[model samples]
Target: AVLGQRHEKNFRPIHYASKIITEAELNYTTTEKEMLAVVKVQLNELNELRDQAYENSLIYKEKTNRLHNSNIKDRVFNIGDRILLFNSRLKIFSGKLKSRWSGLFSISYVFPYGTVELSQPDEPSFKVNGHRLKHYFGGDRPKLVVPDLQTFPKDQ
Candidate 1:
């Protein structure tokens, strides 16, 4: 009878230990599932934030473009007007004192959409974009005067 009582005590401890282990495993699985659900919710929120940031960037770019376009001044040109051509090639070389304008061209024709035909004294006329030309305010014609040497007294 004592042996049977000892066996019963051992069996009871083993059964209780297995029951405790099973409950611990169940709690661990439940916690893991809850953490996974939280991670999924956080991922969804991150995606939404990314989308909102992209939309805000697009809005900012559009507003900047509109402001820039509004600030641009319109230039008008007519036939027979004298203009100076902007020398874009000068930008390649470093020279702050050098002038970027290189022409006293006359506008032979003005076409739609900013195209212009420029004519020089002896050169053939060529078409150029109107944006490269600015009005020359110097004069209708340039003049040259030669000083007579006889007017000055000759030193002995």
Candidate 2:
């Protein structure tokens, strides 16, 4: 089994800002008009860069939303430790407390807004709260493994 490092995210910014552009050096020798033109051009470029950044953010957000909305919680599942959603079912209204350990809840009902719902195997549909579903008693069934296989005679 290959285990990787765990990154716990708690609503903290990963890198406050991504791809910061240094302000262009001022050309004092140039005329005011020329300087204004240069400023406009630089400003346009900056606007373009900002737009691209916003677009990238939207894409990232969409992906995150998709992953969160998916019922397959095991894949890309992160609670309070990474990305967070808004409202969810069962225990709706999560306060961005996502963690790897927290996301390991039920295998069913994953959605945005950081809330999940689960269904018990023996029991019918029942809503669970906060990653941890309400505990239920198991059926009193006989063990499938026989006593002979469970314990061998010392004499033999």
Q: What value of lDDT does candidate 1 attain over all alpha carbons?
A: 0.77
RMSD of 2: 22.2
Local distance difference test scores for all models: 0.77, 0.45
For each candidate, give its TM-score against the true structure: 0.67, 0.32
Candidate 1 structure quality by residue, lDDT tens digits, 77-118: 999988999999999999989989887999999999999999
Candidate 2 contains a number of clashing pairs equal to: 11
Q: Which stretches in model 1 have alpha-carbon errors above 4 Å?
A: 1-28, 140-156
Q: Kindly give the stretch of ten consecutive residues in candidate 1 with the minimal lDDT sum.
A: 12-21
| Model 2, residue 31: C-alpha shift (Å) | 1.9
* Per-residue lDDT of model 2, residues 15-98, tens digit only: 222233334524333354344555566676899999999999999999999988885554343322222222345355464654
Candidate 2 residue 76 Cα shift, in angstroms, is 22
